[model samples]
Target: MRIGIFGTGGMADALGAHWARAGHELLVSGRSAENAAALANRLGAATGTWPEVAAAADVLLLALPAGAVLDVLAASGPLTGKVLVDCTNDPALTGAPVASRIASASPGAHVVKAFNLAPTDIWQLTPPAWEGRPLSVPLCGDDPAALAAVGTLVRDIGATPVAGGGLDRAALLEATAAFVIGLWFAGEDAQAILAPVG
Candidate 1:
């Protein structure tokens, strides 16, 4: 898919890199030309300003923070019928506020919430722990095609995709993040924690 990402952080870069590796036409956009170009160069894809990014992509990814998404979406103008992949979390998440916050502003696109539970390091260090025993990643979205496209990409990374149901199920995904964090703080092994959630 033609993926355009709106953020310039580590998370965005990691996912962008994967998409680039998968041979997708990836666009990295934001206010920072240098940052965007740097990431784009690393990914060996294209880089541009926000407007250019929005105009030339099939799938748009909001790698921004939860609270930032609504305002960005509003300013970004109508994205109706577009496919949006959100990796945002609620700031009020004392124990994972709610993953539904990923769809703030009630996005018009096929919004999917995946890749939020784990650290961006996972993508850089390893897409999944092992090639065969890939990590189980939970996802929730409304469109079957969008979900399946994402499912294929998730599997391409050697990870298991757990269809957590419709878009509203984002709340449950958030709860899982909280649970994962709790387990980690309580000293549970990382690989063993998210395995059963599938």
Candidate 2:
């Protein structure tokens, strides 16, 4: 897979490393060319302009902040028929899911919402395991092929991918993230809030 990551931040570095290790070709681009080059070097991937990366990749990871997603995509030229993976989360909880917004902004692209629940530190984990089990990631997307592609990437990072329904349900995932993040920030054990079902 030719993966284009549109940021040089922690999430980009962590996920890009895993995909690179999985033998996927990578092109990293962002607002800062120097930072992108540095991250590309660290991941053993290539660095290119946003437009070039967008055009060259089979799959594009919008590893940017929530506010920057639309602007960056607009600047990256047409995304028609692209598999766009949205990993952004809105801390403000202001509106719809970022994936839905991205889908609206790029109607021709297949947008998949994923990798937003975990922190960058968790993604840095080689297997992202917890309690002797691999972490389960829930993904929401309308396109079956796009979902399957991202599912492969999830397993590439040694995590389990769970179906999270269609694109319409992506807002629920965002709300879940906001709630869990609040609990985490409040020094509460979010897992304890829910018990296992028999």
Candidate 3:
């Protein structure tokens, strides 16, 4: 599978490494062409402009910051019929879910919300395993095919993909990220808040 990554940041590097190792074709692009070229070289992938990446990929990973998503997509031309995987989390979360907003911005693109809850460090773990179990990633999207594609990518990094329902529920995931991030900063155990399964 050809994957286009839209950032050269930590998340892009971490996830891009996994996908590249999993034998997926990668085109990495960012605001800085030089950084994108460097990252692409490190990952054994290709570097391109944002428009080139968008045109070359079947799946597009928006690994950019939350605030930049709208502006970046707006400048990237049409996204009709594209599978757009959104990994952004807005700490403020003042508006609609990022995935929904991306859907509105791109119109016909299939937007899937994923990989926001986990920190970039976790993705660096080979297989992303905790104890003896693979990490379970929660995903929300309206399109089944798009969800399946993203799910496969999730599994490619040795994580389990759990459905978090449709795109309408993506805000919940974003809210959870904000709350969990707060707990992490406060040096609290976020797992203590959840009860054991019955």
Candidate 4:
């Protein structure tokens, strides 16, 4: 897959490593060319400006904070045919409906909501984390074809993909991230907090 990742932050770098390991050609972008190139070099993926990266990818990962996502997408131009993956959630985000808006903007493209429920380390699990085989990643998207494509991406990163159904289900997905962050902020251990789910 010709993948492009925006932000080049921890989550972006982590996910990019998984793709690099899987032999995908990855292009990473960030606000700072130095940081982006550094991360790209560290992960053995290609590095370029954000617009260049966005234009070249078959799949694009929005690895920015929720507050900045909309502007970033708009600045990147009409992502009409790209597979847009959003891994962001801000408790303070306002007036923007991402999944539908992104889909509408992209026309024939598919928008998927994912990777926001857990920390970056979730992808670094030594023994893959699904219930039966490894850890299961729950994703929600309105488009089935897009969801399936995301499932493939999630599976590529050594996770079991759990389809949480329509894009509206992101309400649950967003709230889940809040709860997880709360638990982590409360100083709970992974085993203790994830006990029920894990």
Q: Model 3 off-target regions past 4 Å?
A: none
Ranking of predictions according to TM-score = 2, 3, 4, 1
User: How does each model score on TM-score?
Assistant: 0.83, 0.97, 0.97, 0.86
User: In model 4, how large is the Cα lDDT of residue 153?
Assistant: 84
Error of 4 at 98 (Å): 4.8
- What tens-digit string does per-residue lDDT give for candidate 1 at 51-137? 677768777878887666666666665676667777776534654333354355545567888877876777664566544455777
Candidate no. 2 TM-score: 0.97
Rank order (by lDDT, best first): 2, 3, 4, 1
Every model: Cα RMSD to truth: 3.1, 0.9, 1.0, 2.9
Task: Put down candidate 3 lDDT per residue, 143-182, tens digits, no spaces.
Answer: 9999999999999999999999999999999999999999
Which candidate would rank higher by lDDT, 1 or 4?
A: 4
Model 3, residue 98: what's the lDDT?
84
Tens digits of per-residue lDDT for model 4 on 28-130? 8888889988988988888877678888998999898776676777778667778899887765434455555566656666788888777777666643554
Off by over 4 Å in 4: 93-108, 127-133, 189-198
Worst 10 residues of 1 by lDDT: 95-104
Worst 10 residues of 3 by lDDT: 127-136
Q: Over all chains combined, what TM-score does candidate 4 have?
A: 0.86
Query: Candidate 2 on 13-92: residue-level lDDT in tens?
Result: 99999999999999999999899989999999888888899999999999999999999998999999899998898978
